[model samples]
Target: MTMSLGPYASFIVTSYAAAAIVVAILIGWVVLDYRNQARRLRELDRSGVTRRSGRSAVDTP
Candidate 1:
């Protein structure tokens, strides 16, 4: 079986590929940022720095 994209096959395929690449990059960036932030919070906690509520930075509730 085969599918056709008419006269704009290359354009359509390129657009989809570009979108996928952008989404992948964004996801990677978010994951790295989250890890970096968590590490920073841990360091702060070790140094006795904490929230104004006197709770650990890594703590939830």
Candidate 2:
């Protein structure tokens, strides 16, 4: 059996393939960045570095 996408098939197929490639690249980049950031945070924490929150600041009387 054979499937066919009549006229404009080439253009349509190419567009879909391009979009898929772009999405895959974006997902991979995000995953890598998350892992790198997490590792850095862990290293910082071990070295006595702290992440300050806005509310942690002392208020002046």
Clashes (N, CA, C under 3 Å) per candidate: 0, 0
TM-score attained by model 1: 0.82
Q: What are the models' TM-scores?
A: 0.82, 0.80
Give the clashing pairs for model 2.
none
Q: Could you give candidate 1's per-residue lDDT for residues 1-61 as a string of tens digits?
A: 8999999999999999999999999999999999999999999999999687866678755
How far does residue 7 in candidate 2 sit from its true spot (Å)?
Answer: 1.4
RMSD score of candidate 1 (Å): 5.4
* Backbone clashes (count) for model 2: 0
What are the Cα lDDT values of the candidates? 0.94, 0.89
